[model samples]
Every structure is written in structure tokens, then in C-alpha cells.
Target: MIDSVQRDSSLLVHFTLKLADGSTAESTRNNGKPALFCLGDGSLSEGLENQLIGLKVGDKHAFALESEDAFGGISPDLIQYFSRRDFMQAGEPEVGAIMLFSGMDGNEMPGVIREISGDSITVDFNHPLAGQTIHFDVEVLEINPVLEAANADPVG
Candidate 1:
């Protein structure tokens, strides 16, 4: 192992995300491919990335993050009602099923069907892991320190 991970360094790590109940929610180790990420990149949330700082190669650690530190708690305003007719073309809307709906920006946004009331269907746009505590288990496999601007090639 070299030294501790520092800002701007690229890291290769295996991580597992689990809920309080010990049920695995996601894992990169299972796929046999370690995740590669550069510090300071937006790919990871600040809260989650902060937990990785100072870890060195071959280090294993777990962090517990509250709902606020992880994904924010569910927001009631994110739940919306849409007429049944609007979703007939896509397919049947079933409770607990996640579907992609066109957002105001014309991009697709995922929402889970929470309830059905006659002609009205309620969809919740909050993240599936919102409002919960998460156990983040990480193993740092490799760390590639970033070269200074003066020593690095802008393009190769």
C-alpha cells in the first residue's frame, strides 16, 4: 500500500451498501469489478465521499450514515397524482412498480407507484433509499495519485 487516499486521487474500491436490517441493497464486489472514481468528482455525494478520505489501499471500513447524510428523507411534495388515462399507453401501472415519466425538462424521471384510487394513480418520486440509515462497507484496492497540472499532459 502506498499512502492514504488524497483529494484528486483516483481510487479503485469494492463497496457494499446495506440497510439496517442487514439486507444487501447493492454491491460492486458481487460484479467482480471494483469501482473506479476520482475524488472531487460529482459521481459521489459529498457525504459519502468524505467517508473515504484518508483510507489507504488494502484498508477495509464501514460507515453508518443517517438519512440526512445519505439520501434525504422522503418528501411528501414529491408524491404526485396522475390520471389513469395518461399511463395507458406505457403499460399497466402496478403498485410498487417503478416507472419512468417525462419530467418538466423533458428528461425521464423514475417514480414508484404507491397507490391507485379509481382513475387516479399516485406516484412517489423520492429515491428508494430515502429516509433510512445505510451501512457503507468499503475496501480500498488501489489508489492512483493525481499528477500536478504542470507535470501532467493536458491531452494525450
Candidate 2:
């Protein structure tokens, strides 16, 4: 039998994330390709996955998630300060600039520049949606069932 977003199923979908005031935060519709992700993967938050579970192909749903249920409250610790000299090679750092920095694990981490002092630059590494109530709108286009190995269809 074919799958339709049951447990552990991979899904190709289109999604829009909106803020509490109905402003679009992010959207897959703007991108050329639909997103593909499996259930329980880190691609989605647990609250979001809970809402998407059991949805069948071509199904559309909207979920209103609270700040805690969404990306969770922003942490003050995630805001860090760096020396102005540290950004010299990257050009001048300004407020609201999102820059990619290499972490200890060698992964690219994005931090938004929030303040610029005479010698210190404040950067926030928190998720952009953190501490905000967000609306998740999703449309499931296709389902790919996975067993020990993934035996799925192309998302064309």
C-alpha cells in the first residue's frame, strides 16, 4: 500500500511561516522546489511535527503555535559580543547584519549583528522566530514511506 504521511514518512511539501501579525516570516513557495523532510527529523520543530502528523497527500493545514510551543523563548545567553577588530576582514559590521561565522564544530552558524559599540559588536545567535508566536501553514504534496531503506517516489 502507498503511504500518506503516517509515522516516519518523508514528505515533499510547501510551507509558509507567518508572524503573529500575519506577516510572512519564511516560505517555501518562493523557492523553486518543494521541501522534502522526514518525520522526527530536525527539519521541523516537535510542535510543528505534531501538527503535521497524519496529514495525507495534498492536505493543507494551519497551526497557531505559542512562543514556547514554537521556537521557544529567546535566550539572553545567545546574544554575544565580539571585538570590532574581529570584523575588519569582513568589512565594517553594522546593525541588523546577518553574518555567517564558523563555529568550533566547523559548521556555519548565522548571527545577526544587533549593536555596535566603540570596540564591541553585539550579535544574536538565536533563531529568528524565537520568543514569537508563529503561524505555520503547510501543504503536503507527496509522501515517501521509509523502511530500513527509503523506497520513495521522486517529488516531481
Candidate 3:
């Protein structure tokens, strides 16, 4: 038995992600090779994977995801106000610039520049897709069954 993107591990695939505004956010079709990733990896959102399950090679699909199931609904806490001086100290912060900053736990997090006031710069650390629904267009170009995967695995 084999699973497509729904499987724990997918060898290769081609897909496109479109925002609610009908704009492409990401796509593997642009490249000649299909995108490949190990399942359960943080690379894909669970909600996005749910739509890909049970699909087979050459399957093309489109699905809409709610904010909660996608990057998760917008969290007020994720919004932070930083001092303009602090932002300048780090470097000249510009509107629409994405920044990398340390989280409270010291993990690096990415935040986008939203607004710049006199002394405060608002940064949104939430996933860009957070708080919004997204559409995914997928085409399964190939399926490497488990038997073939086992044969390729060194341990198997």
C-alpha cells in the first residue's frame, strides 16, 4: 500500500498553493522536478496534508482551508510592539521587511514588518498564512510504493 502526500513519506510531488486572493504562494510545477519531503516533517501544515490524502499519481486537486486548519487562526499574542530604537539598533527596519528575532525561549522566529510608528514598530510573528484560508492545487505526478521504498532503504 502507498499514500500520496498523505503518506508518512512522499518521494516526489508537484503542487501549488494559492492564497484566498487567488494568488500563488508556492508551486513545485515551476521546477522540472516535483517537490519531495518526508512526511510528518514540519514543512507542511497538517490541514494542508488532510486534503492530499487518498490521492494517486496524476491526481489534480484544489481545496480551501480555514485559518484554524491552515497556519492557525491569528493570535493576538503573536502580535508584538517593539521600540523603534531597538529596531534601529538591530538595523534599519523597513515596512514589509521580514525579520528574524529570538523568541522568549531563545528560538529564532520570523516576523513581518507591519507598521512603523514614531517609537514603536509592529511585527507579526505568526505564520504568513495564519488567520486566513488558503487554496491548494495539487498534482500527484508519481507514487513510490512502500515495497519500492523498502528496497531503497539501506536498513530494509
Which candidate has the highest lDDT of all? 1
Point out the worst 10-residue segment of candidate 3 by lDDT: 144-153
What tens digits encode model 3's per-residue C-alpha lDDT throughout 1-156? Answer: 564545575646777878888998888878765776555777777877777767777788888888887779888899999897776658889999999999789999999999998888999988888888878777776665354446765665
The whole-model C-alpha lDDT of candidate 2 against the native structure comes to 0.86
Model 3 Cα shift for residue 75 (angstroms): 0.8
Q: In model 2, what is the error at residue 136, expressed in angstroms? A: 1.2
lDDT of candidate 1 over 21-81, digit per residue (tens): 9999989978888888788977766788788889998999999899878887899999999
lDDT (C-alpha, whole model) for all candidates: 0.88, 0.86, 0.78
Root-mean-square deviation of Cα positions for candidate 1 versus the true structure, in angstroms: 3.8
Q: Provide TM-scores for the models.
A: 0.85, 0.85, 0.80
Q: lDDT score, residue 21, model 3?
A: 86
Model 2's C-alpha root-mean-square deviation from the true structure amounts to 4.3
Off by over 4 Å in 2: 145-156
- What is the lDDT for 73 in model 2? 90
